[model samples]
Target: MTQLNEKLTLKQIEAIIEEMSIDGALNKLYAFKEEYGTKVDKLIVKYEKKKLQWEKEFKRFEDMRRYEKEAYSEGVKYIAGIDEAGRGPLAGPVVAAAVILPENVFINGLNDSKKLSEKQREKLFSEITEKAVAYEVGIVDEKIIDELNILNATKVAMEIAVESLKVKPDLLLIDSVKLDSLKIPQKSIIKGDSLSISIAAASIIAKVTRDRLLEEMDSIYPEYGFKKHKGYGTKEHIEAIRKFGICPIHRVSFTKNFTL
Candidate 1:
């Protein structure tokens, strides 16, 4: 009998269930089979259906693991992914993250931060930080973003986050931007967060960090709806900005519907 508590892939668990059924482990079979009903023949079918669901989830993680291994090779011991959030927002800080995850750490359903729901991202964000070998965050405030322009400010923030890391990465996997000053080898992968696990991890970190900052801003500027939209120029945010004018965190350079 296969141990259910062991960390078996969903596929493996399904296989064990099938084998147990073939040998007529009724107690074990009935335990899982109860989800379907009491009919013996129906139970077999139910097991298959449930097994398929697990297989899909298992495959998702397996694919992610394969990519991590590929990147881990090529002499890249510490491959950090870089990404930023709050660039287009009219207020709050621009946040960036540099994350060097463990070589063997595998988390399911990690992808571009934009594609994930807030709940999913929050869960994965915690997992990444706990499991990563080294991680760092950089924040460029609204005033600085306005003064330096978003592109340059984003670059500065990214560099700061990377430099802040305790483990200096040998290679940088970035999303659509290159750092010329950092002599380390780098690859600017277009939509890297979707394609690379490391980049996806960075995206999650940057997003969560920036969201926390905006939440804090929300407390300070209660009228701006920073907590809801995280400083983005939504309808409510625009209305609030129009009513309140730009606060200390608002980007003066941005042409919000209403500005000081």
Candidate 2:
């Protein structure tokens, strides 16, 4: 076999690396290193780092699915994961999502919405919606949030989301809050979005849905920069509130401290 040398372009090596799975790519890189010690040195180092990253990510995804596996074992055919978004934002409605994913479903890069980049979350949002057995989103406007308080409003949204599911769930894996009103069996796991695949899917759905709403709100309240901060109380958002006063979408209770 001819040893690869400067005749082999870096781009060619990179393309080969991209086509293989993490383990396959790593093994091939190691073999290449053995054959052409310093010739493929840079490629070996790059793929070595990539292998570590892929391993860590795979472990995280495996851990996230533990809850779903347990539910599946216990004859829970449809397990819904529920989570909410926009709870802490100073503007926009609080949104909740309930998602029931197929048993043993695996989607690469699925994780808590907070742990993902915007682009990753967007990509996964579409994937989850398309692949889920059932999914529904519940949104409570700022008025309802202020009237009911964030906690109660979130509960209402969650319940609505659960009710909206086309496929009724046999079990509910909720993130940090159990709905007493819900007759379905449920487990409220703290940070379930990070610990449960279903909840992670719900978190992604809620986050993306609320973000899109806030983006539209940005058009109406251009002064608030909803598109940038997504209604979080950043210095810029607070400055906008102070400059333009509260918009119709601002949660009055949350913005009580502001002069508006």
Candidate 3:
């Protein structure tokens, strides 16, 4: 036990903590606790809590990558994850994203887009696009959604996303739905956005793309508050539709019941 100066200020000790390995820091902190008193004890506790939290995050991240690992183990290269956004929305286009991520890529706080805040999604969106091997988005507007129905429209968007990828993926890991439009070898996982990091990355890209589009639509249809709800059928948006009538961005098939 290296004897830390009994009088060392917490700020000074904190600086020392940064220089040590996590285990070394914890040991050093523990050794100093009695001499430095209660504040030092609190620091030890805080450090432990932080360490535990980090462990949880790392485990979750590793678990999220399991599907990618499986694919990689099978001699697969260029595995892409597919996910879509705006399928349930009453307005705007259904957008899908296909993202190929580097094997064992470490991205902290990566998860399903629905599980993250808008700010988090936006941040991860930038991180993913920057670090991804390749990524592409497909957008199918409300008119086509009405024509083909949401499920088929979503498939088309996903097909477009896969087709547009700069690097064609050798394997596709999709979220809950299979794409028959493309003949790419694929696996679908239920709630895959939460189960697979690749799907989560694709989810973030699809969500951010669709949200930005809805925000752009907000400028055109100010009364609908598209930016706030991102085309979801919030009461505010429903009220706006009832009052202002359906706009071009509103899915005719979806809003028909609401309008009536």
Q: Estimate each model's TM-score.
A: 0.80, 0.86, 0.89
Of the two candidates 2 and 3, the one with more favorable lDDT, higher being better, is 3
Residues 1-260, model 2: lDDT tens digits: 36555466767767877889877887887776665677778887887788788788778888888888887888889999999999999999999999999886778899899999999999999899889999999999999999989999999999999999999999999999989999999999998888999999999999999999999988988988999999999999998888889989999999989863
lDDT (10s digit) by residue, model 1, range 1-260: 23553444445435666666333544555654444344344555665566676578667655654545766676578888899887888888889999998887768677889999999999999899889999999998887888899999999999999999999898888888999888888889887887778888999999988998888878888887889999887889888877778888888888554764
Highest lDDT: give the candidate number: 3
Give the least accurate 10-residue stretch of model 3, judged by summed lDDT.
1-10
In angstroms, give how far residue 242 of model 3 lies from its true place.
1.1
TM-score comparison, 1 vs 3, better candidate? 3
Q: What lDDT would each prediction earn against the true structure?
A: 0.80, 0.91, 0.92
In candidate 1, stretches whose alpha carbon ends up further than 4 angstroms from where it belongs are 1-51, 57-68
* Rank by TM-score (best first): 3, 2, 1
Clashing pairs in 3: none
Model 1: lDDT to the true structure: 0.80
Against the hidden true structure, what lDDT does model 2 obtain? 0.91
